[model samples]
Each structure stands twice: as structure tokens, then as C-alpha cells.
Target: MAATMPAPAASGHNGRMLSTYPLLSSQIAFGLILAVGLYLFISERLRVDVTAMLILLALVLTGVLDSKQALSGFASEPAIIVAAVFVISGALAATGISERLGAWIGRAAGVHEWRTIAVVMPAVALLAAFTHHVMVTAMMLPLLLRHARDRQLPASRLLMPMSLAASLGTTLTLFSAPAFLLASDMLQRAGTDGLGIFSITPIGIALVLVGTSYMLGARWLLPKRSGTHGDDDYLRLDRYRTELLVVKDGRWTTRPLSELHKALGARFRLLGWLRDGVRRDDLTATSPLLAGDVLLVEASADELLSLHDDPGLDLNAIVRFNDTVSGEGAPQLVQAVVAPGSEFIGRSIRELDFARQFHAVIAGLWRREGDMADRLSDARLREGDLLVLYGRPSRFSDLAAHHGFLMLVPFAGEAKRRVHAPLALLILGVTILAAATEWLSAPLAFLMGAVAMVSTRCVDIQQAYRGIDVRIFVMIAGVIPLGIAMEQTGTADLLARGLSHMVAGWPALPILLVMFTAAALLTQVMSDAATTVLLGPVAISLARTLDLPPTPFVVCTALGAVVAFLTPIGHHGNLLILGPGQYRFGDFLRIGLPLTVVIALVSAWMARWLWLGGPLLPLSG
Candidate 1:
């Protein structure tokens, strides 16, 4: 998430005159007006970042907060920590450690659904909690989908589970969820105390268990869409088929296919031979003696094209140049899924200059629910849109490698060295040390880790920048001032007073549950960071008025805000998988609602046990 400016102080220059209005009512009214505007009109009309900026501007104009306060969120530690987390996550991805883990999981679990879910969910969650969920989702989603397709498992069965696993994985730590960071900052600002690394572990663990159980049950509840039965159609191995020609004047015309194989080694394979359009299945090592013969082969377009240009043989008359481009000069076809928070979202190929800038052609485009457009050039791409590109082989490969875009086809060519293993392990070690020893703050340790990644070349400078979600940073910077405004205007205190008056006779447990539910619901409609920023202070004020520890209520508000799963609007991770998972709007509601409820109940109880007294009782008015 991006950083936001805090609202100006109430007694500032403009506030000196605006002070004629009652501070508490005016502040509450201002906050309500902004919140309603965001919820009802701005949300549907403007980009979230734009709307957030508008809110920030509103706070400043109203004298609810000053310029410095409004911009403070950008400089906040939580924002820096999140930015660092993204960079580190990118470094890990560049090293292929995340892929190795998925490969290991696939190998270990093989095709068993239960075993796969069990190992994959917790593993991804634990790993992602420290890193960015976007990285985790990008790395794991395609792998899971491919594995499921290979094993003839239902995409419907596996995709949702994978998305959930990645989402749940992020909830394990504060840095894991952007919402947590925002809430933590708001709480600290409100003088309610900030959460330490692993401070939420007790409640987080319980939520995980409940969420996992809900997911396991959801496997039965979720619709089971069958995999495509026609493997040949989906696999499209025929597209990879090619024929090498042997001309009368060619140097290698007299050599057997095995001889060519021996020279080329395993880099190229000889499928069979074609003699005058007649198929020859036998690879007789000694059967040479042929001019004008054709060799049917299984090789990539690049390899075929490279051989086309070799001066050692006469390739002109031997090879038939079909629609397929061959050699390094030939265009390569690659498929990639656009991920959440990608800068490309909402832009068309024309606007992006995708072909001119990237040196690629948009061959095909796919969205989960929408009809495939006749031309990708005119279609606007959204997060989760799958794109097929025809481009220079090297460029296509490079695009897939660096950008978090998932290549639909199995990776071809030599694998990059696995730097992810040591880097991931190092990050884990640092996180553990910081969490356990408290030698350094989590943010500082993570920042150090990000620096290490850059210095060590785990991720390049370009990729590090690409990985950071500037939109989120902007949102954070814009919303922070509004949060500050709520506090300075006495809006939070007023809201808390009103809530306490209404729930005076109700048990504290129910009140806490209501607060948690409200936060969760609001998170679905608004930004999670904004939800926490707005509600956390109110929750804390309520606790303070009741003469109880503010920690439990504040923690509930924070956790509740982050646990929104019922809508794609709630979290970027949820939106990231929509197109790839082939999920509809209803799909999220079916699975996420129960999980949200389960987490809310469990988190509330855990907070009570850990922070509040054994059982919660109503406050005596």
C-alpha cells in the first residue's frame, strides 16, 4: 500500500477561524461526508488512488488537518516496510525459490487433492506472511493450475483453493497484510499502542486454523467445474511440430538422423523422418543415403529458425517456411497472465504502445467471463487478463521472466540459476531473528533484507522498482491525513460515545463482534487501509471509555479489516486470481463469506482471551 498524509491539526492557521464549528460534530460530519462520498459515488466513478487523493484534499481544505500531517503516511514506517517487502518478494521470485517450493510440493503430493491443499496452503501462507501476497499469488497460481490440468483435476476445484491459500498466507504477519500496517499506524497515532512483530500470532494462528477448516469444507461447497477432457486440443503439441529438409546439395543430406542427433546432443530431438511426404518411423542409425529427404522433428521455433540460417547446409530448398517463424529471427509465441496492481491494467495496447515499446504483437487475449475480443489491440486489459504474444523469442522470454506475468506454456530453454533458495532462507532467518530477539524492528529488518537483496543481486534495480506497487503507496499517502483528521476533529471520540451509548446494556463480546463485522464489511467496499484507519480509532476510543484494555478491540478492528475475502474489491490478491481462476463475482461470495465469519468469531474470542479478561461483560454506564 502507498503512504498517506495525515490530516492537519485542528488548531492550525485555517482551523483558527473554522473552530467556530463544534470540533467533534464537525470532524465526525467531515469524515462521514468523505466516507459516504467514497462509498456511494467516488468509488464507482474514479480510480481508488484518485478518490483517496480527493479525500486528502477535502481534509486539508476543511482545516481538519494540515499539509504536513496529510503527507505523513508516505513517510510512515509501515509504508516503507511494505515497499521493502515488495522488493524482497521480487528478489525471491527472481531466484526461483518460490517455484522450487511449488515443484517440491507438486512432487511430494503428486496428484492428491487433500495432501496438496494441506501442504500448499500453510506453506504459501507462512512464506507470504513475510513477503508480498502478489508475488506469492503470481508464483503459485499458474503452477497449481498447470499441475491440476496435468493431473486431470478440476480447475474449479484447485484454482479457488490456490487463491485462498495465497490470501491466507499473507494474513500470518503484519507485513503480510497492508491493512494491518495501516491499522497499526492509526493505533499508534491514537496512543493505543502499536503491535510488535508476531504480537498477533496467537489470534492469527487461530484464524488460520478456522479459515483452513472452512476452505476444506468449501472444497465440497464450491462448484466443481470439470477439466477439458480433450487433452490433445488443450496441449496443442501439433503446433510445435516441424520438418527439417535435406537438400541434394546439403552437407548433412547423406548423414542419418542419429548422426545429426549425436552432433546436436540432447538439445535437439529427432522425432521421425519424412521421405517424399511419406512418414518413416524407424530411426535407423545406419540408414543414411538420401538427398531431398525430410526430417520430421520436435523442436521450438527458435531452434528450427537457427538451423534455417546455418551456412554449413543448403536450407533454402529443404525447409518449408509455414506460418510458423523459425530461427532466432522468427517470432516466438508466448502466453502470460496479467497480475493484480499491474500498471498495464485499464490501458489498451494502443495507449501502452505494447508492440512498439515491448517489441511484441498481441496475438490473443482471454478474460474469464468476457468474450474474447476480435483484436487484442483495441481491448483494454484488466488484472488477471491472459494475453498471448508473438514476438522476438528472447524478448518474449524476458517479459515472462522479469515481470510477474505467468507463462502458460511450460518454460523452454535453460533454467535460470536457482537463487531463490538461499535468499528465501536468509529472509526467513532474518525475520525469525527479529521477531524472536527483538533486536530490530520488523520494518528495519525487512528493509535490511531488501537492501541485501539488491546488493546481492537477488533482484535487479529495474525489477525492484517494478515490484513496488506505487498505487498502493499513493493510496496510503492520501488516506493517512483523513485518518488523522478523524482523530483531531474528535470524530472518533464522538463515534465511540455514540456506540457505547447504544450498546450500553449489551455484553462487550457482542460489541466487539459487531465492531469486527463492521470493519470487515467496510473493507469489502472501501480500501482495507482506509477501513482500519477510520475504524481503529473508534474501537480504541470505545475501549478507553469502558475502562478496558484497548488492545483487544483495536486488534479486532485491524484483523477484521484485513480478513475481507468476499469481494474482489476487498483485496488485490483476490482480484489477481479472478481471470486466471476463471472466477465469477459469485464465486468469491460463496467461499469467502463463511471464511470471513469464521475468522471474525475466532479472532474476537482469541483477542478476549489474550488481552481482555476471560469473558467479556458489558461496561457499567
Candidate 2:
């Protein structure tokens, strides 16, 4: 089952390695590759996708696996399902079905804070169960923020619950997250029936209830800060930092001052006018621009930086680095996470012209560690900083890019298109019914659904392509070979035999708990997909050694992989809310530790009852 992949990840050393080497045994090669992969994974040396491919390359070069076996994950059922789900999620967003559902839920919010949360949080959880949780969070993010503004409640109170609920939703369905899908893929590859669509849903119900109740009872622990989602506070903290530069060959030199104001005034705020380094108060709306004249205008740091890209006027920082400069860097703010390959990523607001470029204002920014309002104008942008971008209805499409940015707050009374919603809904519903009812294979059903989205024009092909998170796709595909290598090399059996001896006399409950706890802990430090990939084969081998069903062990491993409540880095959804909730790293510990414990206990308990029925009684009997 060889696979095709995105050119970037599939290229590099793989080309030469395809030629092969017979120098080492497959076991030696597998062990060496595993060691190096672990080092790269832990050291944060390269992107996880790159590291995965490197591991694949090692496996093939040393003959641990053929190229087809090494790259099989790209064509696996899990990969197809995961990639297809992203497109379906995008179609929902494009047609505004998810947004419309979120808005309807928002309307249920009353003046009472708890009541409002009661309505919003569970609805978010339910929605997440079917669609991708990150998209669910992204869809609901704006609704909750709007409710916070309309009711004058704390935005902080709403965001963390929404994020947590989205994460918890992963457990409720077979395909909500890659961890679950991978779990199913592993089981199927082992010659067992894969997970049913709602197989773990009972456990999900318990976890969701536990999380919701915990957030409500511990409301006092939630941050009370104004959701730093608005740029108004930043405006108060610092006045306009950028001054407009009119070059000798400027595009706007012949245009009237009023005309320029009317065009970009919504973005780059024009305070007044200046000439020859002097503030000119007498400049009227009808005043004509001059070749060398300067205007006192306000723009975001990134927007100012983006001005360098303009064909006309240039930020003088290039001409005179020290002349009237605020700071350096392309500081592009984020809405949810920066769209994965966004032009704005890694650039500071000062480095790009967000205001004029995107026709948006950075009202508030949320970083994982600190409040950004203090240095709002010059803060460097990262992938997961939830930026409050205030722009008009016209800019919504570009701001979010068809569901690329999850959990972004939108302008009040944001217009949504219902025209395409019915067709999108029908396509998604048909796909789910066909798969859930066993009329079609999950992968085929989802693939058809994704294709339907494009054919039906619910979302264009470009949008569908954009919706797939290549990092996740490549990471999963790259690592699948590790499992294959482990099985093919007899390493899993070796490790499994050893584990059986240590737990010879113990009931399976405690061992299950241990396995679950280990998975949960590892998920905190790495991507859940990686954790699941590393541990899943071991769970399978161990179950076989003990003469017990592998399903529960695998299920528990997946459950733990998905329960990443203990840290923000555990999941992208957590980082999505990190800034909006104004949470500290310590806050996750205080809030999520208990939830993690509860989920672990509930998951192991359920897995035992569902799959084991009794502890492993006669190991190797």
C-alpha cells in the first residue's frame, strides 16, 4: 500500500535513499531510526512532519521497510478520513451552517452568566462531536465573544470553556480528531474491526459532563480580565505610532486628502497632517497630497511593515532606520491561529501593514504567556496568538480563509450566506449516514463528501485544499511506518512479553489505568497523534501477550491521547484560547489537572467494563 504525499515532505533525502542499502538488519535499522526520531521529536529540532519523513527515509535506506511500507500511512484509511473531514468542516464554514448554529446558541444566552455558559458550552461539545473540534471551536469563538460583548460579561469566562468543550468532543466520535482515527486505523491493520462511529461516545458523555461541571463550579478560578480581544485598550495604551510617508513618485500624490481618508481611513487611521517635519493643523479635507509631504497616520506594526510592499510610499525605516521609527519586525497579529502558512506568521505588526493590507485593526491580541496590550503595536506574531481583528463584513472571507483560522471573533451583525447551506448540509449528512450505517467505508464516504463539496461548489477546490492541515497529514503519514516497522521487526512482541511479566498478578484495571495515564501525560509534551502512534502498537502487542482483547488497551491509549487538559501546548485548541482566555500556564494545571484525573478514571473504568468485562485472568495460559 504505497502512498503519494505533498511534494515538500516527500522530497529531500528520500530520493537518494530510495536506491537502498543492505548494510544493516531491519531490527538494527528500525531501532536506530526510532532513537533518532525520538531525539528529534523531543529536542524540537525540526518540524514534526519533517522529522517523520526523516524517520521514514532511515527505515527505507537500511531495508527495515520497503518504500511502500514506509510511506503507506499517506494512503491509509485514517489519513483519507482526516483529510476529508477538514474539507467537510471547511464547507460547513463556507456555507455558514456552523456559524448559524453558533449564533442560534448565542441567542439562548440570558443575562445570567451561568445560564449563558450552560447553553453555550454543551452546544459546542455536541457540535464538535460530529465535525472537527478545532473548527467547532473556531466557529463558536465569535459567537461567545459577541455574547460577552452584548451582555458585558467577561470574555475570559466564555473562551476557556469553549476550547475545553471542543477538545472533550474528540472522544465522542470515531473521527473527530486524528488520535481517534489513528486508533481505529491501528485496530483495522491488526485484523480487528475498527471503531464504530459512536463507539466511545458513552465515555465521552461522562467526560463532557465532568468538564462542564468543573468549569461552572470553579468559575472563580477563571480569569476576570477583559478578553484582550479588542484593540481599543491598545489604542488607549499607545496613540498612533506610525506616520504616513508620501514618496516623490507616490501613487496617492495626486489624490485629495479626503479621498485617501475615505479609502483607507477604516484601516489606517488618519489623525491630521504634517509637512517638513512640522504638524500642519490647517490642512483641510480637500487638500491635495504633495510629493514630499508627510501625513500623521496610524497603522498596526505589521501593516506599517506591509507598506514596504506597496509600489508607492515606503516606510522610512529602510531610508533612515533611526528616523521616526517605532520598532522592527513583521508583527502580524492572529485571529485564532495564524492561518498555517499565512503571510503574517513570524512577522511583527510593525513589519506588515495589517491595517491597510487586510483592512482590519488589531483590537486585542492573546498570547500564551503574557498580555499583549502593553506592547500592542510592535508585538511579534506567532501561529496561535488569538488576535481580535476588527474589520468590516467585506473582509471576513480573507480574514478566516474558509475555516483556516479557528475560533475567530467576527464583527457584530456579520452577514452569513445561507444559500449554499442546504446543499452542504445534504452532502455532509449523506456521507455520515452512509458511513455510520455501514453502506460505505468511512474513508470512501468521506472522500466522496470532500469531492462533493468541490463539485457542488459549497467550497471551491482551493478552499478545500487550504482546509487540510498538511502538517497533521504528513505527520500521521510519516509515523505510520514506525508502527509497521515495530510489528515487522518483532520489537512489539519483545516489549509486550516483558510488560506481561511485570503485571503478572495484578488486575487489568490498574494496568489499564497506568497505560491511560502514560498516554495522557505524553500528550501534554507532544502532539497527540505522535503519542498515539508511538504507544498504539505497544498496547496491541501487550494485549496479545497477556491473552486479553487488544481493543480496550487500544481504546484506553486513544482516550488518554485525546485528554490533553493539563497544558496549552497539549492541543492547538488550547493555544487558540490561550490569548482569548488570558490564561497563564499555571492556570491550566489548576483547572485541567482535576479534569485530567477525572477523564482518566472515567476512561479506564469504561474501557474495562466495555471491552474486558473481567481482568486478564490467565496470562499466557
Best-performing candidate as measured by lDDT: 2
The model with the greatest TM-score is 1
Candidate 1 — which residues are off by over 4 angstroms? 1-29, 40-42, 227-420, 615-621
Tell me each candidate's RMSD, in Å, in order.
13.5, 16.1
In order, the Cα lDDT scores of the candidates are: 0.67, 0.74
lDDT string, candidate 2, 274-317, tens digits: 67767788888898888777665555433343344445565433
lDDT of 2: 0.74
Each model's TM-score, in the order given?
0.68, 0.67
Model 1 lDDT tens row, 478-519: 777766777777778888999999888776678779889988
Model 1 quality (TM-score): 0.68
Candidate 2: stretches off by over 4 Å: 1-25, 231-417, 614-621
